[model samples]
Target: MPHTKTSDGVRIAYQVRGDGPPLVLLAGQANDHHWWDDVRDDFSDVRSTVTIDYRGTGESDKPHLPYSVERFADDVVAVLDELAVHRADVYGTSMGGRVAQCLAARHTQRVRALVLGCTSPGGQHGIERSGEVRRSLIQSDPEEARQALLKLMYTPAWLAMHPGPYHTLGDRSMPAHARRGHLVASNGHDAWDALPGIVAPTLVLHGTDDLLNPVANAPLMAARIPGARLQLIQGARHAYFEECRDLASPLVLDFLDQKAPLR
Candidate 1:
């Protein structure tokens, strides 16, 4: 139950788990550290882990103000600094991935490796779904939202085949403050040109059927980072970790394990 103060004085809560080299987990939009409940223990074999609740999410302090990607990146740095960790293998999903990308670009020394999951390069906007559809989606129930979100992240057949697990995602909810921050952060996200500047050893993962942020985003990211490798999990969705933990965990653990020597 430890917390760190960001430069702006917001308290960011984080938890250290397992035992090995350090691996920091950055959750997706509106998601708290609990989102990692399923996969957190899976990586224990390879590294010690730190799961963080971003400034506006989870147990972290949330203030009314404009949320920027830069601020989120700073929050990550502040946590690492408070923990006395000079370097760590960073794992970010969706909005969290955007923060990790910014961290690698601005604070190269602090990040030893990176795992960017179901993310996109900012310049290229995703999803031109009907405005009526989009409006309806915002007002939609969590279950409907979850179904739509899962569909956007994975293919149709995959969702049809895996109702139990996908339904579990809809049941998980975020705090009100986190929901607000997610709207602000997501609205502000756009990083098309900055990808080339990220220097950390990076892994870009996406699902071919991801409708929210398509698989094309993966290559777009890979093409920019010097030697970053791309892994497209077939039939998976944006919540790839939840949908395909067996496949995703090993890939992430392998990447983190390989970076232990450098860290």
Candidate 2:
């Protein structure tokens, strides 16, 4: 466990695993470095996976203030700087994808390649979730909410075997103010203008049935990032990266190993 101070003086916690070409793993909303727990070892054979706890989550400083995707990216950069990793392949999911967008676009030189999983560009351009899905997220019953989230994030077959829905959802113990700030940061993300500016060789991944961020946003983001490739994981949902790690892990490795063309 290690911590680094961001340009704004916030402490970000990070962990590194394996040893090879560096691969930065950015977590989704309200998630921490543990977001990669299920899959970090999968990538250990060929890549050094670096994960961080975004501000207001995990062991990082919890600031009761507004948060932004850009600030989150800066926090990532700060950790990387502390580790002396100037540039690395980046993978981010959901809100992490939005943060990756800001990172690659605003700090283009620090990202060697980019992977966006089940994420959106935000603003009016990103496809909105269905009414039923949105309503399910706010359900008062914990079990009901858990069931709804399981359905939204994992295919029924996968959930049948993996009954632990609580673990699927990342840490939920952050303070109410931090949680609120996370909501504001993720919902307020507007990367439509920044997408085209990402020069890294990009890979846009999504589940064919992802209702949380919607599958349509995958191609939309791919088309915007220059020379970006799109891969849809069949029969997976919002958490395809976790549910189908067998498929995604290799795809990411192949992408990072290739000579990505930015045309």
Candidate 3:
């Protein structure tokens, strides 16, 4: 594991693996690098994958403070700087996707190919989760909430067949203040204006049945980002990238491999 310090003095930890052009894997709110545990192998064959533990989660320093999506993106920039990775492809899912957007929009030259998975631009332009889904996710009991999240993320059949990284999906041990920051940062995300400004070749992927971030936003985002492509995994939900990864892995790999590696 490698570590870096942000301008704000927060310690950020990251991992780099494989042997090719670097691929930064950004996880959703409260999720660390483990979010890509299942899919990372698929990428590592053709890419050097970099996964980070966001400030409030995993091995990174957790300071109680207000958080913004842009701040999270900056943290990523710091990690990249630490690694001396001048340019690389990025794949962000859920809140990580929002972070990826700011990374591409704000630090234009750093990102080569971009993939936004199960995420939105936020603010008025983003379609939020349905009220029913909201109630389910906001349960009082932490265990109850985790169970509820499991139901919402994957289809029943997938959950029945595979007991994948469900336990590691959310960080319950994090301090209350840090968890609060995660929520506020995700809820406050607004990247509508930033979409068009992204110069990286982009791909937008979503689950048609996504309950957390609605699928409707995928096409809207693809349309807004210049020359972005949209791909929806039918009958999949929030964790479609994991659930239907066999289909998605190739799609993403093809798109990423199309570009010549930058020197």
Global local distance difference test of model 3? 0.89
lDDT of 3 by residue, 97-135 (tens): 999999999999999999999999999999988898889
Q: Choose 1 or 2, whichever is better by lDDT.
A: 2
**TM-score of each candidate?**
0.87, 0.96, 0.97
Local accuracy of candidate 2 as per-residue lDDT tens digits, 1-263: 68998877788889988888788988889888877788888887777888999899899999876799989998889888998888888999999999999999999999999999999999999999989999998889987987788788888888889876344475787888888888899999999998888999899999999998899999999998889999999888988888999899888888888954322
RMSD, one per candidate, in order:
2.9, 2.3, 1.2
Model 3 residue 114 distance off true place after TM-score fit, in angstroms? 0.4
Clashes of each: 6, 0, 0
Q: List the residue pairs that clash in candidate 2.
A: none
The TM-score, computed over Cα atoms with residue i paired to residue i, of candidate 3 is: 0.97
| Residue pairs that clash (backbone atoms under 3 angstroms), model 1 | 122-190, 122-191, 152-211, 153-237, 153-238, 154-237
